[model samples]
Structures are given as structure tokens and as C-alpha cells.
Target: MQLSSFKSFPLNTLGRDFAVGDIHGMYSLLEKKLVAVNFNPQKDRLFSVGDLVNRGPESSRVMSFLGQPWFHAIKGNHEDIAIRSATDPDYMDLMLRIGGAWLMDKSPKEQARIRQTFTALPLAMEVQTPAGKIGLVHAECPLDSWDDMIFLLKAGKQDALHLEEKLCWSRRRFKDRDETLIQGLHALVVGHNVVEGMQIMGNTYYIETGAFLLDGEHGMTLLDLVALKPV
Candidate 1:
């Protein structure tokens, strides 16, 4: 399903652009947050660091938002797991345990459609704002070069396990690597690992505040790249 390792968005041309963390089926909270921020469905764009479904409620409904022009998402680990469970017979129970049982509630046709959509999601998106460039990832990116990682992903060189493991399931780099200088990257925003608040490492930022927990000062990072604050 033609996927690009990188996507470029002109954040300045749009009314505004915001990056959000994993949803895990918390559509109601997402909606409320957007409304609070006055997210304009017609002009504003919302990018999700992809774990859009699988834990809270209304997974299918959240998937429907993909059809909207305002919503864009990268492939998160949960989507990877759901795709594997749908295609590989052995992973169904594992999917359910990790919050994919919502898939079982849908019809076979619905399931196929969802799988097709999630499977085609891009692994990374690069936003070129007037301020600087921001890269979106579901989990931690490879420790070294963003360019090298982009090349591997753009070429689609990974096997199924590696694809899921590296792009979706990795956190070693985030924990173990030194915050060295990064090239061609103004900021990197990611989800997957829940953070108490935004954690800044080198040029990277982790904004996954566990919105599914349904409590506290949450709702991901609503960033306005010009000022780099929540807009």
C-alpha cells in the first residue's frame, strides 16, 4: 500500500497544526480537547502520533475520522498489532489483551476495511513550519541519524517483525542513547511511552500523557511551532 517514510506539511499555510499523542479509543476526550483549543475542522489540521484505537471505547468510530481531511496519523504500535492480529491467526488474543478486542465486535467486512486503512499509514511525517522542521514518530526513532532511519523506512527494508519492533515497539534509544546533536531536525515528537509531561531530549519531545487514564493535566502537546507552545 504505497507508504512514504516521510511526509512534508506546510504548517504555516494551514490555519494551525497540532500534534497529539496516542488516543487508544478515547475519542470523547480527544474531541473535548480539540474543542477547547478551538480546532477548526475546515482549516486546522491535527496530526496524531498514532495509537488511535484499541483501549478506551469507539475504536471504529475513531478510525472513521481518518476519512477527514483534518486528521492525519502515523502508524503506531497498536495499529501494527491490530494489523498482525487480523492477518496472523496467532495474534488475535494478544491483540485483545492489548486492547484490540474492539476489532472482534466489528463485522468481517468492517475488519478488513480497518486493516487496509491502518496498514497504509505512514511511519513518519516531517512538518516544515516557518519556525523549523518537526518529525512525528509513534515511538522512539533510531538513536543515531534521522536521515539513516528515514532512508530505511522510505525504502521499506524491514521484515514484518522488524518493522513492528523497530518503528512501533522500540524505546531503547530513548533510554540509552546520549542526547547528541541531530541533523536536519528541529524537533522530534513521539508517543508510545507515556510521560508525566513533555520530556525534551536533544531535539526530541515525548508528549504521550496517557489521555486514556482519564485524569489530570493531559491531552498531549498542542504545539504551535512558531512559538512552540500549545495553541
Candidate 2:
């Protein structure tokens, strides 16, 4: 589908979900963890916090899955840079240094698939549940002043600003526990910074388990939103 067509789908109503952290191209590990938790793709929705590609061996596989009807994703910093590089000539080299090289190595068919998928991802997603609304982004929000995330999203403010740092690269939101809590969103789910395991600071959860086996770990963190449990 075309990029515009992809974005035209309804938002603000993704119900009963599983939000996953940065996959970083670890397709096999992702599959294992999904099966481990008995994930039902048809009935249970899967949403990615972004960074679905790069840093591992299967960018192609990652892109293909993200494009599936059952899967949804936000635009992490890696994806932001990639989209920019794909359209901007000057930034192409920088993008390659930060995992674009792996994407570039894929076959023509794979490359086309990846481009189509990434081009369709949103910068963030708002999931509405019976309890409350949850904001899913690649990195946490910085200002902590905006009470209405939906307004910001509609105002075209979701794109990373020059001083804001890319959402995927900012450490400010993760380091300050008090700041995050004060923001007052029911829950903020993010990936990008890998912790020893999943982290819970107030209602916010960070699930970036470093799925690429970066430190030789064997498991991928999985969050079951409907059941409110982690496996």
C-alpha cells in the first residue's frame, strides 16, 4: 500500500494490546518469545514501540512482520533517521553508519518491502483501553508539560525537534523517575534504552530487553497488556 493509504487507517482505538520494545532485527528471538507466551496474532494485537530494524541479522524479516495487518508500530529514532536518509541526500552516510548499511545489503525485493513498511509507521500511537489511554512511543516525551498528547499529535508536533534529540536517542526521560511520574499519563510504554530486564517507574514501563542478545541474554521481554502480566 502507499504511504498515505497506510496513514489513513483509524487510530485512537487499538484495543486489547501487547506493546513490545525495540526488536533491533532479532526476528528469530522475537518469534521464540511470541510463541513462549502463546501469542495469538488474530485475537491479540501486537504493537511495537519501534526500532524494529537494525543492530541484528534480520532487518528484512522485521520489516515484513511490521507490515502485517496484525502488527502496528511507531517511528523510533532509527526509523526516523532511515526515513530521512531515504529522502535526503546529505544525511545518507550518517544513516548507513547507524544500521542503514544492513538494510542496504538486502536484495532488491527485500529492500522494496522494507521501504514500504517503514514509510508507513507512525511517530507514536495512542491506545485506548477500558482503564485508560496509554501512549506508546519509541522514546519518552521530554517536556512533561503537555497534558493532552492527542493534541500534540494532531498539531504535527510528534516529529523530533532539533533540541529535543531523536526520540530513540534521548536518555533524559528514562533517567529521571520523578519527571516521568509527574507527566501523569496513565502509562507510557517505550523502548530504546535496554535495562537489565523490564522496568516499571510509576505507571510507565520500559520493555527494551535488548532483544538482539547484545549481552548474551537468551530471553526477550514480553508484556501481555490484556492480562496485565509480563512473561
Candidate 3:
């Protein structure tokens, strides 16, 4: 299936909307936290900030979550690595070295299925919330304006490829402590940067609390887009 480079979800008028940080394959931990928060799949929707697989124990279960109707996600850099490794021999070592060794155990057919799943995910997505529109990208939004980012991603040309690199892999915003907000978005949520907690710079929020890190010090973060409180 050819999915768009950008996707937009209408407001969840029926129930609540939640956005989680880089899950990194801690499927059980995520589910436990979801139950703690009383996440009702029957009504609420869960938006993932990408990095759904890798670095953690349960990466194999990623496909099950992907199949769930209520779960939505964007493409993370690890997903990019896994996709490339499936086709290009050069990327295999990189993928295995960086918490993706679990993929090696899968058969060629299973690998292909996983690759197709990640490839189908868009680089960026937005959800309409009662507060306004919230944007979700794996790492950083390259452009200052959301509209420009969407247009460039949709074009999928040479320039878009460069932007895609920044979208999936850039850390300039978090590294430089950039406080500039992207226009046309009420708030932007991103992962890929393992912040101490949910760091709010301008309107952008970094919510990945290193779920993959087994050190008791770090855990997952799940933010309510409707309420948008850091947790």
C-alpha cells in the first residue's frame, strides 16, 4: 500500500486522544501504562511518536500493535534502518548493532512484512485536538512552517528527500535547544531524543523517556493530547 508522506486525523470528538513517546519495543510496559491511564481502545485513540520497534525486548510484538485499528504511528529512524536492512546488505550490520538484532531472527518473509509495515507509515502526521492541531514526527520538523513541511514531504522530490532525512534523523532542535515553534501547529510532539522527562520548548514537546533503557531510572511517557500534561 502506498501511503501518503503526510497524514491528518480529524478531531476525536467521541473520546480522548493520547500520544506516547518512542516505545522502543516495550510493548508490555506500554500496555500496563495504558491500563493505568485507563486507555479505552473502544473510544480513545493512541498516537505513537514512532520508534515503535528496537532497543527493547518485545520488538517482535510490534506487528500486533500495528494491526490494531486504534493505534497510529509515524516513521522513526530505527524503522528506516530496518527497512533499508531488509533490502540493502550494507544496512544489516547497522540495524543489528543498534538494538535491531531481534529482526535477524525473523524469516525473510517476516522481515519483508515488517519492512512493508514501516514503509507504509508516513514521516509526519497530525491530529486535530480540542486545543488545536498537534503534530507528530519521529525526530524534528525541518521547516518552521507545518504547511511547508507537508508540501515538501508530499512532493517527494530531491529536496523532500533531504527534508525526510531531517525528519527521521535530525536532532538539531533538541541539541541546540531550539525554542522556535513550527507555524500552523498548536503543539508538536516528537521522539528520538531521550529527554529526562517531557521537555517543552516553545510549543514542541519531547516525550521519549527512554523506555528501552532497563535502568530503573527511566520509563515510558504517555501524554494526553486533549489535556496535554507531561507525565
* Full candidate order by lDDT, most accurate first: 3, 1, 2
Local lDDT at 10 for model 3:
98
Q: List clashing residue pairs in candidate 3.
A: none
Pick the lDDT winner.
3
| Highest TM-score model number | 3
* Candidate 1 per-residue C-alpha lDDT over 1-231 given as tens digits, one digit per residue, 9 for 90 to 100: 235555668765858888888888877777778888888998888888999998777676788779998888999989888888876877887887877888888899988888888888888888877778888889877645677767766677645337546777788756764475556788888888887777777887777878777443465456665555654
TM-score for each model: 0.90, 0.79, 0.94
What is each predicted model's overall lDDT from 0 to 1? 0.77, 0.66, 0.86
RMSD of each: 2.3, 4.2, 1.8
Q: Which stretches of candidate 1 lie over 4 Å from their true place?
A: 159-164, 215-219
Tens digits of lDDT, candidate 2, 114-137: 666666666556665555656676
Question: What's the CA error at residue 86 for candidate 3, in Å?
Answer: 2.1
Lowest summed lDDT window (length 10), candidate 1 = 214-223
Cα distance off (Å), candidate 3, residue 66: 0.5
Off by over 4 Å in 3: 1-3, 158-161, 214-218
Instruction: After the best TM-score superposition of candidate 3, give how far the Cα of residue 148 lies from its true spot, in angstroms.
Output: 1.0
